[model samples]
Target: MGHFKLLDVFAGCGGMTRGFLDDGEFVSVGAVEVDRSAAATYAANFDPTGGHTFAGDIADYTNVPRADLVIGGPPCQGFSALGKRDPEDVRNQLWREFVRVVRESDARMFVFENVDRFAKTPEFELLRTAASNGGELADFRTQVFRLNAADFGTPQKRIRTIIIGSRIGPVVEPPVTHAKNPIGDVLRWVSLRDAFLAGPVVLEPGVRDEWFPESTADFQNFQVPGPFKLRDLHVTRRYDLTSEIRYAHIAPGKSRLQLPVELQYPCWRKNPAGASDVLGRLRWDQPAVTIRTEFFKPEKGRFLHPQWENGGEQVNRALTHAEAAVVQGFDERHVWHGTKAEIARQIGNAVPPPLARAVAGVVADRLQAG
Candidate 1:
């Protein structure tokens, strides 16, 4: 069968786009992304020979190329749990652009994704109502699915809300292909160990970061992992001495709450019981928590590596740039550009490809039937 054409809006790093391409069920006719670094990363991976890869604002997309489907996850910072839920955030209004393109292009179906809380926002209600009607989608049926990436074999447990609109028929959620702690024939959730170790490039032994000359801080560098095109391995921002000492006190599966009195800071000491998982380590046996843009900082969340023995000494450092990408289900060979911080933002903002593929598999079936 001919491939169903699709367009991606706010296509940061092309995570959803990559998943569709990898699935072989759909072809991208066009994509729009506003951030320079993100758009650069997307262009580097996906060639524009297939279609237009617009690297600017979505609002400027006047003559949209037609496609059978339109898909995107608009910036969700407005409704994300990671930040304050500002009801009037400018980013929330981008969904209007999503709706406009879907209506203008007259696509048979559209898939909109965002943080779970986005479903509860007043802006979502407007987009939902708009997407349900307009052009060929009048009386369009929508299926809202709250999906956790870990349920579909991704190493990280990221819960996202997916809204699929179809003029053809009802869109059904994909069946879980993986489960937590498989019993008998049931599948088990992918563990952090599985993601980090299953890499195209392996970390070189005896290679370690040095301190910057001026500040006496750790300098970040990307290691070449074998012959893989993968860039940015083991790169990280400097952690202050105090944070490092605090991290040293915590073990894998432990957090700041476990730090000794000497290691605990004023805030942590004042409220020892609250704020669990701050400056925490990830458990090797379990799926990792959500990957956020600030995951490089242990203070932000449970991002530390599972302890590994090095010359009888246990090493417990936060996940590197590459490790975070792996956890997000990015291909091992995928290339990333820009500063470590910029890449982190791109990785954190992406939809895990495995999860997107699972959702696409179900959506493809519905569109194919029509």
Candidate 2:
């Protein structure tokens, strides 16, 4: 069977695009992205023909070519748990553009991804109705499901909502391909310990590039290689004396809730029950919390290492870019460009590639069977 052509919308650093292509059953024909950093990252990894990766707003994008499949995860900040779910956020309207492209592209199948909370919004139903009643997707069957990356072997418990549409057959959700740390039928969830090993490992520039090479072949088969350690990493951010002293009291899996009365921040002290993850440390035995953009800062959430002893010093630091990438289901070979913040945003905003691969596998099976 010929490879299915894929058009990726809101293709931030080509996570979904890479995921689909990694299966070796789909080829990305075009991608639309507005962020230059992300767009550059996309170009670095994908070899889309005709330079079809538009590094601009989707609103201005036109003359899009039809494809066999359309896949994307639009800007989900509006529906995310981190921010105010303001109904008036402009990013919310991007879904309309997604539908417009899907309709115009006349793709046989489409996969739309977003935060799990997106399902509760009125637009969820609106988009479904629009896709079902109008344009090329008029007869397309649609299914909406909330899926966890952990279910597909990612070491982070990032939950996302995926909406699938298919005219070829009923859109079926991908089966859970991996159980957590499997020990003979007792399927335990994949833990942070499973994704990254303890590392005081320093990453030299040449070694980092070698591990995460720029070839699609490398990216496709990318793993940490033998004796896996974090690379393409970030320096541990230093904390102020007061913050350091406070953090010293927290243990693995514990947060400010266990801090001494004097160590609690004023806001947390006033509302002791609030912001449960502040100053929290992750448990090595469990999967990580969702790898948010702010995961580099230990104060942001439970981003701290469980117990990484660095050169005989007991240091608690947040996940490095490489560690966070692995936790998000990206292999060591997936490279990112630009500032640390820009790279973190790209990684955080992405659908776990393994999760995307699972979805793409189902779509590919249906398309091939036809």
Candidate 3:
């Protein structure tokens, strides 16, 4: 009975569920996700029987089971900083469904996650107003929190909006367990260099740090340890000679802005001052930037492998799937059930398990105390 049951609404491939499971204090009762491929992936890993899962729009789902905690968020495309931030985007209205399910589930508490920009949007205010105006969500007094994935253990700096609401009483917030260059017991922010859980690689701001176990050959040849092995996910990509030269121009810790005039994309050459992250390369000694849906493409974000200024074997490639999974907080043991693109999207959209585990711990403690 102490094992709190969980209902994961809008669950995206069980990222949040993974956290709760990792916390060892909760059990999944059900999960709902729109993308059938994603839902299949979630079910394969978390709901193999398919009896407690729904793979459709939240509006059409009515099998809300009673649980101690309900966690999820609507699609955040509208509020994502990577998008146009269109207030009129239909996805913005999905929060209404979240509120509806929360009301029906009769859960003691709920956690909502979204892009950081969601906190500032009009839709957020609408949800807040429902809580304040004695609407369906009124019984659940809500508070908003901001959390970063790196602070919770993931090797990427993915910041997100977290809103915790409870009908049982006020909910406690999350804890920050890591920091930049942490001193004593707290861990330093993990960087790409430490993605494999390698030894401490901290260095002065501009100093170029070499990979750990200097005897190891190179980034591409290295295998992800057994503990982090992923099934059915590969990050191998082919590149043309011209693209390779463009990547070479993107030195470690740098971007397409460093490319010479000819190497720059036509659009990039015209808009030199636009995005600095385009065609970017990652730094070995620092946490990665957010891994967006198209992380396989270096032109999309900082998805490139680090290279010495003098050049190396990995200079022309992007992060491998194992590398991206570890940095994004995923274990390879869970079998996947989607196309490569869908799987990539799931990884990009997931709430890092480490962060989710931290939040789940806080909630479980509060429920136990009560």
lDDT of each: 0.75, 0.73, 0.75
The stretch of ten residues in a row with the least summed lDDT in candidate 1 is 211-220
TM-score of 2: 0.84
Candidate 3 clashes between residue pairs 3 or more apart in a chain or in different chains = 230-332
Candidate 3 achieves a global lDDT of: 0.75
lDDT string for model 1 (200-238, tens) is: 445432225522112111112222112213433555556
The CA lDDT at 296 in model 1 is 78
- Name every residue pair that clashes in candidate 1: none
- What is the C-alpha lDDT profile of model 2 across 282-347, one tens digit per residue? 877788989888887887898877663334444556666776777787775565655667777988
TM-score of each: 0.86, 0.84, 0.86
The per-candidate count of clashes, in order, stands at 0, 1, 1
Off by over 4 Å in 2: 48-50, 79-92, 134-136, 180-187, 198-230, 308-313
Better of 1 and 2 by TM-score: 1
